[model samples]
Target chain A: MNAAVTATRGATALDIAAIRRDFPILHQSVNGKPLVYLDNAASSQRPKSVIEAVSRYYEHDHANVHRGVHTLSQRATDAYEGARETIRRFINARDTKEIVFTRGTTEAVNLVAQSFARPGFQPGDEILISALEHHANIVPWQLLREQVGAVLKVIPISEQGEVDFVEFEKLIGPRTRLLALAHVSNALGTIVPVEKFIKVAKQHGVPVLLDGAQAIPHTPVDVQALGCDFYCFSSHKMLGPTGMGVLYGRKELLEAMPPWQGGGDMILSVSFEKTTFNQLPWKFEAGTPHIAGAIGLAAAIDYLETIGMERIAAYEHELLEYATDRLSRVPGLRIVGTAANKAAVVSFTLEGIHPHDIGTILDTEGVAIRTGHHCAMPVMEFFNIPATARASMSFYNTREEIDRLAAALEHTRKVLG
Target chain B: MDLKDLYRDVIVDHNRHPRNFGKLEPADVHADGHNPLCGDRLTMYANLEGEHIKDVKFEGSGCAISVASASLLTEAVKGKSKSEVKELFDDVHALLTQHDAAVDPARLGKLAALSGVREFPARVKCASLCWHTLNAALDRAAEPVSTE
Candidate 1:
């Protein structure tokens, strides 16, 4: 078979119209107009395959995994573990043993903070993170700091929303124990130069954890290549089901850390006095787990792989450029987060208009965008704004939708001005 | 529901140029109000002479509905007895929230504009944030009130 031809707009090999058809939610109307969903950064619309896979799991293979000797239980166990292998390949991790499943990215981060980092933390030890982190990354470290008397140090961001690399290098001192940072910022869409930071942390003998919830969907992630000791991401943000996420840790690191929670499946044998913990991945997962969610996530990974990640990234870059150009022309509109390297998210504010009003007006025009602090309150504090209206794109989103967003924003100005 | 119903002309006008939109010095009581969902924040201040409201003002940043509602609330509550302000607050609350509650527009006057917020269920908190703060200030409560 011949290689797929790349589209004229960058290296995207996707047929936008064909891809839009795969998502069933895209065909509906909201408030008498065709839905223009630019809220993919919040949660992406799942394809039919993912939805079907989830339903298929519940319909045919609904059974407790690794508990019974029945055919259904074995099938469930096979599918669930098969998903772990798929995730391992997707991120190019060394082994499936490093992969752990949790409720989502929040739980994954909390688990690492509580289990791995907390034990080794000492009073006055510094935990370094960026200013652009979501509350999920910040709060967990703050809680850990409060418990262990550790100090949380933030690497300040630049005026353009990018993390200050020079300041970051200066903040890494002898007392710095761990470095946790967002691979991609949810609020500003700024892709952090994590590889360079990871190299610096490695020089200091500090392990790094990357919050990949916002990165994995937009770009290709290779944990082995990134050299991050821990990486966590959410499935819901990547067109998979909610309540399922992946936590990838280096093999040696995970082996050294004690189990986070103790319960049914995370144990090898349970005696009254001494309970032996299960090995590797199973040791991290303690409960019945979201078995169907794992299957659906595997289907999502298959879908994303079918359409290459590089193509999707390129297509979304084009969309972001188109949106930025169109929105820039609107009078009195200020685009926030104009980082040199960024993702497909555009956050902005119109003069004399609150983001809440903008959101309300946009919804009337069938344009769905997120208008809030985006769970990144510190980012808002840095900008000195209450909130911003963010329109984030996916590969399936069209240029016409960007135009609609601009028009709707113009309408908002007219109504509110 | 129509967007116009929620964002009436009067509401828009009030948002553009809010009345009593500043700090009142030597104020007897003041309370801050925050709507965490949308990040709408305002502080309500009142100078009371015994049981009578001598003056009231608010200062903060928020959405159009919230600022407009606060402006209208300050205008309606100034120079009234504490009991009268309390009664007006109840009436305005009923007007903005109760779907089928009978309300006379002429009696409500400028405050009637906020009745449109009832259509947009999510914005009810935006319209009520200032009123809740005002109530807190009247009761001389020290803690900030939050419309979570």
Candidate 2:
């Protein structure tokens, strides 16, 4: 990763107009102006391939998987299992048995807590997380602490929004059961050095869970290479459907942990007296799974592979640099996160105007950006502000969109100030 | 009316320089109201005289609609009887939810500016926060209510 070549390394004179054509949603107008969407951190827009895959699953092969012997059922099972394999390979997991289908990252975290953390954790046992974690990552631990008498420890972050590695090292001790942290912050887009953190956690014999909700979409994630105990991400944020996510837990750890949910598919045999749970992955995923969601995710993964993740990451980094430099120059605008490495998320505050006001004015100009705390109130508290206006980008976003956003911010400042 | 109409000159004015924006120190009743969906919060304070609201005030952070509505609500119920205020609150709720219910702007006074809030579906809670908190505070007037 050459910093100079990646950051603000200008587009390769490659016509982005052709690439933008792939996303159907981008070719529309909002509020009588051409839409310039910059809110990819929340959920990314899907390409035609992903959408068609979902439709094809429903139209041709739709059935409950795992036990069916009929042709449609076999097809469904094959397609579903094939998706699991795709995910396993995409994240570079050691085995397909390690990948579990979840509703999303929230469920994945809850599953780990309920299954592994609950029974063993004691009052003095501390779980280290970062101040930059989303509510999903924070609340589950708080709930687990209440239930199991475990203590929640927060890893303080620097003003630049990067987690303090030195401080995090000090926080880990004998009683630390798990270390859960975000790979890339949803609000600030600060990319955490996971491999280094994982190595440290491994030395302490504390399992690490990487919340790859932000990282997986931007770049290739190799769970085996990173040596993380668990990794989780949502499909919707990666051009797939909502209500479906992936949790990649090491096979040994998952096998040792009890089942989180119990239903039709999760069990091997059930009786009035005793019930035996099914094998790996299935035990974690109970009841009817998100069949369409899995199909959509596979499509999203295929589409991403076709475009090449390296190219996408490179293009997005350039876009982030361009957006950051331009937005920074705007009068009264202050960019919040200045980490050396980040995804294409830019959170900023304008001098006199509120973030909500800026977002409203931008909406009128057909530029969509997120406002408010971006779901990390502590991060806002760290900055000593109530909220910020965030303009997040994706591979599909163009330089022209960022210019429109910058122009809109200028107009908003003029009007508000 | 266009949804943007909610952001009229008067609405923006009230949002910028809200009246009765501080705590009613020695407030007889205090209560908090929150819109969990969007994370908007409002803390209300009232100084009641027998069955009347002698003075009312509020403080919190939220969208422009929320702050403006709080200001308008405090102004409307300040010197009014408790029962009169309750009836007024009901009238405001009806005006916001029922599109066909014709409400005279003059009758609502400063709150008339917020009538356009109905056009923006997402902003209805912002307009109702003060009213809801006032109700909560009044419910616990005899007993001390902790707004926090």
Candidate 3:
């Protein structure tokens, strides 16, 4: 925890121009013009350091981890376990035993839903979630409800795309077993008050699980300070490779829960009659895990540590403010999700023009923005709009790029309106 | 590709004031189409007299290309037989999808305004959603057509 705090507070000022050179994909042009990438919410572009780290792992220390006595096997095992330690320090977790590697955030949530929640749920029990969750957080619990007879309840949000805290407090009952919510709304960019919510749930003796897929990229997450029973986030959203994610659980709860999948690495010894499971973290990781992905993710964490999360957050907050002020000036364009506290995302719709048309016209000007439901169909349904065009920023983005986005939006209005 | 190619004057005019843009009472056939990708939806209704389409109308919400295509389709097939409408559907589909397919302007008439969709591959689904719904209505298919 001391190392993590030192890393967070150690970085100097971020030179935007110098940082842009580190990402190879940012230097290219898309439709005969320089590309203005505002789709960081979907997946952020990786730095060259992360790419080189994966390549170096495959070239030198390529082996299945934790099995052989050979030299390469030992090296690979060290690299993989070393990544676990790095991640433990990154989020300030007390132990590496609590970290379980999964495919991504979706799989991590599914693991908890099956392994932890399903076994203890009763017929009339309830799982409380907010309306702002991505389908990843909603559907797994719904599947669990189908298996067991538990019910799924939702806490509603306000017109500004904020969760109703008063209603959320009222929804907590003795029957509520778990509280699953997103730390940040993917569609609306509304950062939920997670600490307050966790405190409230703790009083009722209900464990909390936070979907930090959108939060981990922009903010520094301290699991100890948060006191969440479980926290899940993806690697690709934070400048690492895809197909890798982390699920941090309380040590006691993970040990007591049954393994979701049974295979070679998860078992201590297998026979025709019965088998014993392995220790913590390995019991949940069933196979030869994503070795290169873990190493690359560790490298990504190192790169971010050098830049510092606090500085990155401050830089992006300014970018979001600049973009919000600029985009609000566009005629007939209404910005959705105007929560007082938001991350770097801006979702909006133009009158008399569909989002698809807006996306197409923006592409011609070499501006890339996401257009659709953003996989939050309930958010779209709540607003009574089919879809929205979104521009999400990252630390590497500049105010000049926001100006280009605004200019392209103006051109879209003229073409489609 | 130029934005003007996709958003032609004809498409803009028809999208603003769509022809036959309401439900038909005592309709002979009706079917709904939905594009889950962009949440564009439309319902096609036709009043047929014998084998010919006597009247055609649509009621729904969509982008300019979808609404304009449906409006143009209704006008083109107002007096045509069922087989002729099917052939028109195939022709417009080819024009939207195939890059090298030749289009005869004299035959397509106002429907030729959608020829610009060939330049934009992603919008092809948006342009052809209404035509697929029209085919379902003509065939009396029960399931709703989806352009996923």
Estimate, for each residue in B37-129, the C-alpha lDDT of model 2 and write its tens digit: 444678999998889999899998777778888988988998898899988888898777778867676778877777777776666877898
For model 2, how does the per-residue alpha-carbon lDDT over A1-417 read when each residue is reduced to its tens digit? 011122234443333565566789987888887888899999999988888999898899998888788888889999999999999989998889999999999899988888889977888899999989998889999999999899999999999999999999999999999999999999899999888888899999999998999999998888989899989999999999999999999999999999877889999999999999999889988898998899899999998887778878888888999899999899999999889999999999888676876877788788999988888888887898778889999987877778889999998765554
lDDT (Cα, tens digit) per residue for candidate 3, span A135-231: 9999999999999999999999999999989999999999999999999999999999999999999999999999999999998999999999999
In terms of docking quality, how is candidate 3 classified? medium
Q: Write the per-residue lDDT of candidate 1 for residues A268-297, one digit (tens) a residue.
A: 999999999999999999988999989999
Best by DockQ: 3
Which pairs in model 3 have colliding backbones? none
Question: Each candidate's DockQ score against the native complex?
Answer: 0.73, 0.28, 0.76
How does each model score on TM-score?
A: 0.97, 0.93, 0.95
Q: Distance from true position, residue A263, model 2, in Å?
A: 2.1
What is the RMSD of candidate 1?
Answer: 3.7
| Residue ranges of candidate 2 with Cα displaced over 4 Å | A1-15, B1-4, B36-39, B142-148
Candidate 1 residue spans exceeding 4 A from truth: A1-10, B141-148
User: Which scores higher on lDDT, 1 or 2?
Assistant: 1
Sort by lDDT, best first: 1, 3, 2
Q: In angstroms, give how far residue B37 of model 3 lies from its true place.
A: 1.9
Give, for candidate 2 chain A, the lowest lDDT window spanning 10 residues. Answer: A1-10
Report RMSD (Å) for each prediction in the order shown: 3.7, 3.8, 4.7
Greater DockQ among 1 and 2 belongs to: 1
Local lDDT at A106 for model 3:
95
